[model samples]
Target: MVSKAVVSTISLILVVGVALAVVAFVHHKNGTKSAGENLSPSMKAMIDICGMTDHQEICQKSLSPVAEKGSMDPKEFIKAAIQSTINELSKSMNFTDNLVKNVSSSARLIKMGLDDCKELLQFAVEDLQSSFSMVDDNDLRNMNDTEKDADLKNWLSAVISFQENCRDEFQDAPEYQSLMTKNLQDASLHTDNALAIVCNLGDILKYFGLEFNIKPSGGRRLLSEDGYPSWLSASDIKVLALQDNGRIRPNVVVAKDGSGQFKSIAAALATYPKNHRGRYVIYVKAGIYDEYIIVQRDQKHVFIYGDGARKTIVTGNKNYRNHKTQESASFSVLGNRFMAKSMGFRNTAGPEGHQAVALRVQSDRAIFYNCRMDGYQDTLYVQAYRQFFRNCVISGTVDFIFGDSATVIQNSLIIVRKPMDGQFNTVTAQGRARKNETRGLVIHNCRIVPEQELSPLRFKIQTYLGRPWKEYARTVIMETTLGDFINPAGYHVWNETSFALETCSYLEYANRGPGANTNRRVRWKGVRVINRREALKYTANYFIHAYYWLKGTGVPYLPTFR
Candidate 1:
């Protein structure tokens, strides 16, 4: 027979254990950890790994079965996680597709949103498959393997983004919410956990005595002290006749004082060769030449650099409020392989004036370095083909930087000024209409800050990173510093019924500062944190295809990026 004191003590211990269980249950229900640390090594490993992700508990739970199989190899463990991610993504595709079909709403908006979810889910599946395939490389020490690893990480990130996007699209559609809520959330949670492990690829590789870095090649540095690329040759560096500067003569010079080759920029452009084989460099001297300029399609290989970005100003006021954006640009470019440096293009439209494009670039392989574009809306239109913007200062009110071009805006300052009353400021509105379209927007190593005059309560003002102007819109913001002026939600919807929120691809990688904290970001799959590999793909060297021609221009740009 046990003593009465021992029996009481045993009963008390049981009561404590049951109370702890209830606490754990409540914590788990609230989507957080229970307050305890004692766990098995495998469980701890799961926790440790999942801790790096946004969804730790779910990640650990979903990956628990594979972990129990007892493989400690970090590589094997991660492979299993990725495989799990792939499986979930595939199911998610089917789930979203079936959900779309089952919805009873005949509203076009609901249909459009659901259709967007299916399209993005399909992309997620494809990307996840590619990511899984990439994980089977033979050696981790080789550059090929490193590149493959990078590609895998990018695809995985994309998978997570698409999944989140699918769910966010239905947030406003309460009628279809029940169908998408659980499955989409589960799919996103799985990928978020997978990406948490993938984010540590460098450290994980280090654990296996390996590393991943870009192969270094010997080359002249193209990046200037001002963060711009100096592509000018010795001849392009020279001054015009009667400028009194000791610099050499430019190919064609435009001077308001009539001291150079031509008095007006238009006159000089009119006389330009129609079929030039080599670069035709035109130098514009210091002046605010209020005329609207156009470099036609025949003016290929054109290089236009001005005296200074501020000193040489091109100003106009044509806006959609008055005229069409197609005809209202301060400067229009359609020639391929065109370059511009140290110039200012301005559309002097106020916040109320809409669709005023300062610079419209339709040129393929166009490069703008150390340029200033000032306007209210549609300040810089990256219209078509591929383009690069380096060391530029662009300021506007709404959709200031936009269009369908595959563009890389790097090492630039994008300023958002005070908008018209009751209007929100949107930085980018990418128009990638088709899934197969190669056009996208990559804003890398740039500073997105509010104008100083608009900053007393800047955080109170609504500023979004971007919005999807088209269904297949894609944009990546990498290694950038965003000011506190940015909205916590990061991006906005084009409209309550627009399906763009589902079909768009938006991501941020390695960003910093107060605005970069994603805790308050909208729970949309379109926005995510990407790996180094994905971020590298959008650089000026790689994203804009600058390697081929950038070198030829004597620009010391990274020979491997874009």
Candidate 2:
């Protein structure tokens, strides 16, 4: 028989284990409850600050960076957090008296730990605002791919930790009833407001995709050190005389004043803000501007109307034979509300194996009307998003009209100036990278003509309409007049016996002229010859958002194919 003392001791150990199990079970049950069901001390505190629980989701997203991601900077994230906390705390003026009733001595210790996080919250907000100010537009534009990726990754990690901390206040601390509850609820509301700003910033980024890093060939450079607007300014043009017949001439030799003249047109353009609204006009006299031009983002609602397309020309002679394709471009535009009419843009780099360009328009709301663009290979680079060309004439040889943009060309004359080697003709190189970029070129009512001297049979001398620049190279020819010199096989391969055409989107719709016969047109396996209706879907209204742009601008005469 066991001793009575030994048996009693064994029974006591079992009872202690059972008691511990019961306590653990109760803790787990309370932890799993919803925000409304089993409110933690921190949660209650947050509710007290916010004054209500209605905007819980907003708070959650705002605090998401601080609460979930950790060390993240989002727009309004810090602002929302502080404001929400203040709002919630003000809801109960009697919160201080009730605090004693809810929290025990142990709960007060837990609440103190949360108090430590207050500094972190303040730091996060200050850091975000400071970061925003610190990152100049130029710095942001110049940031390399690696630098951008690393910065974004670091920000995301900080946000994750911050969010996780928030969850701890709501779930782990059940003791300090009033204080903990108030902290949690207030933090949540602040996070929500912050998140609203973050989401808006995200939307803007999605559309612009962070303005591309400045490349040697992409950005504008100054030719003259004299402090003058590289291009004509609105103020300079105001003194000029505009004849009733549309001819314009500068009254006096306009001198650059110290007000805002920059080293280069590109430099001037770079300083433009994103959301600013106003009118800007750059009027040029009948003189050749030998320097490269860059129209920047803040130069919105801008009109660069020249005296004559051929006379008031912006000309450069950089060629691929001497310079790289990107370096050869004569003019570049990166403004939102941009327009260029009756201007001659020429890259006289000749077809001596040079990739010279006449014009490159890389803006959201860009329009080029009655303009002449002349170059050889890789000319007229449509380098970015949402560009349009109306009644413009482009002349080039191989892979000329190429780029990564959602572009539309209507009622334009496309001239193919063949090279001496009798190599390629009419290269409409489309650079559609993503599937979301379904917006491609829609050539409507345009005339496709080869060099006047070239015979119809000369088109067979190794000519192609476009080649695969990306997996989804979307280019279309719709209701255009194709000359007899166009190749019977409307499209040609980027390389012989290649698989590039399988994924590229080459479409033609109801194109007329001697070369439009179906039997003779190149029958690529995946090319799409869409109908008039399908082509119109990519036309003025849909692609340009014409109605929206003109709604309040008071600009009559919207562009149409008809």
Candidate 3:
């Protein structure tokens, strides 16, 4: 795919030459050279408004033949051109403006920046389509005769110049590279339309024996509707709790000997199908159960909704001193399209070694809405693809919500129970496959508050938002309220050494609170401080597709963008 600049350059050279020839012919036919072509004040004003006055002299000279002799309505042609240019430019600006209005300092601004950049290109493509639609269809087929030759040349020159300016803006602007990346990879259909119109103008002039030679428009729409490299729509949502019937009946009720029916819950789970339609919902009764639960691989599209987070506790004591990392998990979900609502998943493992896991989810298209995860060190492992947690409470110490997945935690409360010395709250070890896997973590619109505040001498309580294990352990906070317990330096590297800084991509944006001091923020070489335009690209439309699919679930609060 050629850059828009290169195409503009080629088109410019072709159109400029044609304009000069038209001027020569007009002068020859009139048998005298007047002071430039007699351009209407309207045409001049249109040129001035579009910032194309620098080419006013060229337009006047080129339009001489058409002014003297042409059947086409020059005013109509110019109006079409002016309207096209304005529409395109306005659309591009709108996309960028919306991005800056939505993120906070604790938000992950870098990933947001990249996504905004992609959207900008999309707008540009849409603009191009509008530009193409403005070109008169009849003009494309008609050949310019002796009288219309100058008009043909002038119109072609102006259209080419308009396109050239678009090329110039994108090429010279440093930010344009990031924003234009995907479109450049494969120009979208709309962009192709604009390119086609620009190229066709030359052919229209050529039919009149003009000197212009426009290149072919070789654009193709890059993104596909089918779920491919990009996620198009939220598919596979699981609902565990239905509105009226088939609500998940977990068997943890009071039984014959003071012991609840923990085993019965497993038996009830056995009745669930290997894979159900759309989303899966499992409704659990309120109880204090000492049960270790597992949703096996075959139970696809399974969702578990409980009475309430505190009231419905799925707990087991798998402390570091007693169990291995694999065997220590209190609840493990290994099915696809799994979701849980209003449930509490806890592992009472002391903050010594990697022992407890409140919930381990290794499912694609999984979510935990209005739930709670409680533990110390590795509480909730967001262990797989496209996972989300909304309006949930996660309380822990030392890298509690850590994992290697493309997960999103939005509008949730992160409670640091015991702020450790030099320990950070979240450590995202995103195992983004080297140069391949586009995986990371996103924390948006969340609140970070601690149980108690400590003194500075007790070791700065260094609560970094994240540490990047892969080059892209991406984390962000948008519109989040942070308490004074949050450390000023928002992130920390693996070691004091700077080696990891080169690969890690930790960052924040627009956060507020006494703890959100920008002056003391960690100055990592890999991390970046981003603006709002960059953050909005990873919008709810892109991230939480399942929410749109399963919006009716009685989950009280979910992140929504109008």
Candidate 4:
């Protein structure tokens, strides 16, 4: 795929020429300049505003088209810029709508992807409209500095997030490579320019003898450079224990042959220690336990370990055809501080079974170590809060590792199995509804390989990195081995019509292996080449607050990539 920037450069040149023509006219209107002798008031204003922006060329081009039409007031130019941004967003939204129709009409393969696009694009439009309304509100209630600080800055930051979420929504789509990442990113940059200019409204007004006092809009820092979070403080990881042992003691034993305290794991859970500050360990003997298990929310700091992933398997077959994918999991863990090791969670529902989940975690600080999550689709749903998986084998056909949570999968094998006809394999389906929420999928130092069964079906290379189940979905694959089995485009995005592919944050950093070379990778602007500082934001150390939690869990993981 050709770089959009290169393709659009000719157009930008033409646009810039027209803008210069307008600048000449504005120069004369400002009552100065013999062609290019001296800069006028309007030209100075333009420079002043554009100078504060990151992308000066984009700012000038966007404002030039509007400023050429007789308006010289900085305030008016800011409004025009906002209106132009909203117009671009509407066009992008319409484009996505067309994509929904086109993809839906084509081979049924991309229907799900397009549907997700439509939903996310709709949200993007709403967010842009909301941002525009924020400007309108400023016009109505001449905001004090307090309102400007509290309201305007937050809204502008959200506007940036709006663009990002829109891009991320299609991060894993099929046509991800062909999408208009550059155009959408340009639009975002233009809006950011407007934001930068408008944020200085107080200073602008001060020149008119108005007492408009306000400070700079230092953006909302979602993640620190070090990834250290206030929520995952050191104190949060320590368990209240009566004993001084390094690990938790088993409260009950579960075995299939009635050799332990209970025959079923659920029965063993019945005797769970109450009000215990430390972990309650459940010793499960090696056996195939055919049951659907639910670890309720109250079972705090619970630990479950088996002999091995293959030797001690817990399997079920309930699927979305009979139960909700949100509920059809073989194992649902909702307890905070839950840790599982050397266990296998399987949902034996075949490709046709649809939406079967092996393990769905709705817990905080949940850790899975040396485990195997095997299923066809939606295998491991990290539903809510924070979770970590290390040295695990996660296998499935479609959307195997999914959900909306702050999740990190390190030193694991993420396999793409061949699915039922008409369904392509997508490794991750991130569901992040809100823009500001600290939720995303992190695939770090893992192996992205194809399932051997896929070779027989001739679908060993038709797999995607992920697709957005929500608009604000984010995922990063860092220091991982992406096998040659991956599709060259990397992702199978949601819709082909709009710039949905531009909104996703599907990133990679210093990955090695045949498929890790990014020369032919998706041209999606959101698929970025991040540095170590940016990559470490998704690492176990700072991203999941590993320093506070991993020590006690005994999970062998590097807290930081550095």
Give lDDT tens digits, candidate 3, residues 331-389: 88867667787889898765665547788876656778889998877788775445778
lDDT of 4: 0.70
Candidate 4 has its poorest 10 consecutive residues by lDDT at 235-244
lDDT of each: 0.72, 0.55, 0.53, 0.70
Q: Give the alpha carbon lDDT tens digit for every residue of 1-562 in model 1.
A: 4785895686566446534543553546557886554444454455456656666555565556655765555566676777777777677668767866776786655676778677667767766676566665544444232335445554565565455445555555675766676777667667766766776665655654566654567443554453333554333333212122434345789999988889888988887865656567788999999898988867887878898999998888887654545567899997777888889999987777787889999776788888999998889988666778888999997889987777888788999998887788999988775453446898887899999867985867799999887777899987789998899999888865667776788988888778898878777777788888877777765665464446444333543333
**Candidate 2 lDDT score at position 483:** 77
Candidate 2 lDDT by residue in tens digits, 38-82: 433333333232223245444443343343333322223334454
lDDT of 2: 0.55
**Which of candidates 1 and 3 is the stronger one according to lDDT?**
1
Model 4, 479-557: lDDT tens digits are 9998877777777776444335656678889898977877777787677779988887888866666665565444678
By lDDT, the better pick of 1 and 4 is 1
Ranking by lDDT: 1, 4, 2, 3
True-structure lDDT of candidate 3: 0.53
In Å, residue 114's CA in model 2 sits off its true spot by: 47
Off by over 4 Å in 2: 1-277, 455-462, 497-499, 550-561
- Candidate 4's displacement at residue 400, Å, is 0.9
Best by TM-score: 4
